[model samples]
Target: MKSHLPEKIYLASPVWLQNVLVSTYGAFEHRRRYSGPHKKYVEYLRKNVFLNKTEIADLQSKLLERTLKHAAQTVPAYQALNLGPTPKLTDFPLLERESIAMNAEAFLSSKYKKEKLITLFTGGSSASPLKIYISEEARQKSYSFWQLFYDRMDFHVGDRKATLVGRKIQEPDSNNPPFWRYNLKDRQLLFSSYHLSEKNVAAYLKKLNSFQPKIIEGYPLSIYRLADQIIQNSIKLSFTPTGVSTSSENFTQKQREIIEEAFGCKVFDQYGSAESVVFASECEHGNMHIEPEYGVLEVLTNEGKIESEGSGELIATSLLNEAMPLIRYRIGDLGEITESNCPCGRASKILTELYGKVGAVIINEGRQAPTAAIAIAFEYLEGIKNAQIIQNEPGKVTVRLVKRTNFDSKSEEFMIWELKKMLGQSLKISIDYVTEIPPEHNGKYCMVVQNYYKFTVPD
Candidate 1:
């Protein structure tokens, strides 16, 4: 019998893992992460050595100075930022997409030449296209924490693993070994997230069962969708994962419930982006704990004030990176600073809830959220592949679907009846079948798009 695992683990692994490995290696030079050096480092990190607000400000003081020193020598952008010495965090130049596009090298620090940087190509999650170079130390720091974060989450480095994630569309050369990371001693099944057509999902599932990874991570939407298909087929599975983590996209309540039901593990929801920082992760009880060790996050209101003590727009500063520091960088997402602390007793700030990305469209009418509740009806309906609620006009909605089979009248009526029960019958509902559902220009999976910004209220 094969084991079943969700297909989106790679996106969440970077930040947490980067912190883990660096912290561990620093503590003990020659120890395996699960045992000697790694264990001690995890203990020290979890208990001691986290920077608070004042401490972060102090670190930023030195970091900004170092960054300025580097930029003046290497980065053209900063010399051009043309600030006087002793620039405050706000004083540091803001490198939005426009600034980079205008003059890419202008952002480079003067200290290090462009050739010195180990460049990492960044496919901007937003519409922008450009490659950003990160310093070697910054790159190491970016990946260092994986072992440490896993230790924090109880995943030891020595533990064998399988990673189901998005990979290069072309299959690896057959002559090469099946496992890609040759240096890493542990075993892994590196399956491609893109090749998950229904025809091949079973094959992937079978391979995952054989690999039996202790931890599985990936984007939320794709993982849940694959799990839904696996569960629908009623294939017997024995996937006893210690943890399942999600990243790159928002994890809705509906998706969480379905993921748990399908995989039988807690969903460790991770938040952040590829270019900058790894902000938070869900504890056992579902509260989000931000990575206060390396980054500081602030919540600003729609009016651009820091109003959401717990939830608001996230304006973050990455304290760890001196390579290309993102000082008070605005990564668009709505959230609040949570007053509620977790029962687990970690003192890290809890990010109560994240309302997806700026691209996410939550269904609502007036001040009330009818679309929010209706969206929950899509937990894990067997045989129903994927569903998206799109509103083209007022009072009229379209339920676009990517189906596994043609919906008979009875099945369609049942779905409509369930939707009505959730979204109110007064709202006109139309169902459409398509070979594929298109994403918003930003390459984000938008579950709903209401052009008029008005939706039906649930009676």
Candidate 2:
């Protein structure tokens, strides 16, 4: 996986070039303007986040009542319920992704025009792939909530930042140093998750140091890999960020330690999804608080009963997104709620733990590679029903793939090429064609498993 490209190439590149590209292409390609409602919602959330428990609950109740009334009146899917003037939350039935897919039109509000609707595609990290639509207002509100969270981290608009999400910014087969791009619109540096291999860590570090971002935001797994590399190489960064925000995947305790140690800053972990049904973020005190202004989050057991203070599957109902209201939506994630109050004075519900993807780390030549690297490699390949990576020993890896009807030798060749590009050619890669990929014993489908190397929080 070692690229012949010199590391100095990235360091030698002028910062103005990145700025120019971001200002031109980034602005034209992906530009979003916050609507009036979006700004109002953000301001409201800033005030509400510090409200007392009773006030917060009252506010949520009012929003819930409004959302339910809107869904009953405008959404075709909820019309059959014949909800009364004052409807309880339990009056609506639980909604699954299958139901949404089968009757997507029924979920749309007749109030919004076709032009206002925007379709969003999920990364298929979960069991079900979704193509959901939201109104422009809903999308902006989501962005507003993110801004509110960033503000809590002392981050303001137009701050120099870096993101390590699952964006395919690099060629799968290209072995190069510039595995990142700059977005001038938001002044953000976008890093390619596909190129975060052991061999390219130094190059990534070089570029990141050159950028000197004030905030680093990305998936926990991807950020952890970069932080781990920095620690292992004893790399001294010239610039220090105020905060490191993680989302999309689970932020483990071990990862928090490594990131905090490497960056000399706090790691603010966030738990939210594209569905916009539920949202939570870590406060300055490191307490994970569920934002009541975003949506109604309910922890339900397997029997479909609500739990007050325990671990269970998260069921959410979005109060925003009037264009396509999702009531009693079963967001496929696990969480634990606690009655303990946050000392930070935010009376919002506290989440003791939140679990999403448990991706493992593959050890090769004493260098650890995150499973996200492998996942991003095969993300573009077609005919993959489901894919899993398992590493039981050093220097060897097993790829378990549930292939679709079109899978062939060429598909295997493509996969091998992508894998070798990230995991060096010296390691042995065994592909196992299976009929199905089963979930773990706990009913969670782990995309990556490493039996040889286990990461734990240091005592």
Candidate 3:
């Protein structure tokens, strides 16, 4: 019998081979052209990041005007509104996920055909699943913005980077050696979030040591787990990254401390969504600076009025993504904006505070489980009005649900199966039916909560 394993798994295999395969596949099959739009956007971002406050705001206003005009002219949803030329930002109605979900085609531009546009989905962080459409140009521009942001830490394209996110690169049920898949095109080592147990941490560390990534990027919790294991076991690595970049989930202060201490580098926390409507990244001085070049972020009150300066719901209008221009889209997240300039001298708007979904760290038999695994299980499920995963004790999880009247037993069965698959089969899952799952006293609804134990990095 012949053994079946990736060539990269072999000790004798050359690393360049993996890179070649990834690049070739991405260019030909994925149709990813990393030159034209990406380069243009990168150049634009490089220049825009250093602009003064007034200049940045002026740039955003021009971009917003163009995007709003384009949306009003091309999109069916906007066309019905009868918005006048040079209409105020408030003149356009606020867009919601439900509106897009109900009629996605109406949101798309008439200029692009359905086949020509790229479809993307975003529900990892929230209950509402949104199906978004973007043009090839928009997709590349989005990637370019990320590249420019990463460049702040001296990271460039094709740099040796490791990522730990929700991608199902490895089989969920399989417990094997290659818990990560190497992407040669981007020179990225994609690690499986599902295989981050105590028994598998050694394998993950071994791969990281071998890969010797110059930069590490992933969800804050996932990276913290790896850092925790390394620090707790006193494991030394062959290489140290320049910095660690985190996104997708809320990067808490404690997680930041542990990651920085363990990796011996600063952690850059980035806040963005799949919608491409708003973007913010941490600067060298640790201030979260909103990129006005990307979008116009407005902190609005519950009554749809803009806040002069304080905490409120985040509503954004994309300066990019003209393919499906979302004007004043309610992002369903809370944050605060400040007029204070960063010590780093960047005059971009500052995000003083962000109160997004900070998922919990569930413990099963002394092993840390990724909250993403639980979050993903509920993705695209019907009749789930809202849900929350609470872990108060080890090996036990309480799922509080605000289900629709039509939610059936089959839905419950599927939820149980999904929970058991990630959290061990021996885990105790209690489904608690509720009329409503309210937010904490601070008015933030954290989907996942872990109260059992706090995993920390030792001095």
Candidate 2 lDDT over 234-330, as tens digits, reads 8899989999998766666777899999998999988876777877888899988888878888888867697656788778899877888898887
Q: Candidate 1: list runs displaced more than 4 Å.
A: 1-44, 47-85, 92-95, 169-186, 306-311, 357-459
lDDT of 1 by residue, 1-459 (tens): 011121123223453453344334434522322342434444545553344546545654675566555544454555566666555555654345445434556655555567887554332223222345566555555444555456545786546565554332122221222222211444444444434445556776676676677877665655665577666787656667787777656655776777777777888876765555445767777777776655667776656565326555676766555566555555545577764446766656778767654223323221112222233344323334456776666556787776654346655665565454333345578888776766555334456666766322112
Please give the TM-score that candidate 3 achieves against the real structure.
0.85
| For model 3, the run of ten residues with the poorest summed lDDT | 1-10
Write candidate 3's Cα lDDT for 1-459 as tens digits: 011244215323443554455456655533464654788878878877788878977887888888888888899999998987776787887777668766778988888898988777665445544667888888888787788778877998678999987645443455776777677667788887767878899999999999999899987888988888887888998888989998767766777888887888999988887788988999999998888878888878767688645779888888888888888888878889887868888998889888775656676765455555556667545456667888888778898887765578877876676566565577899999998878777666667787777754345
Instruction: Indicate the TM-score of model 2.
Output: 0.81
Q: Name the top lDDT candidate.
A: 3
> What's the distance in Å from true for residue 319, model 1?
1.6
Better of 1 and 3 by lDDT: 3
lDDT-better candidate, 1 vs 2? 2
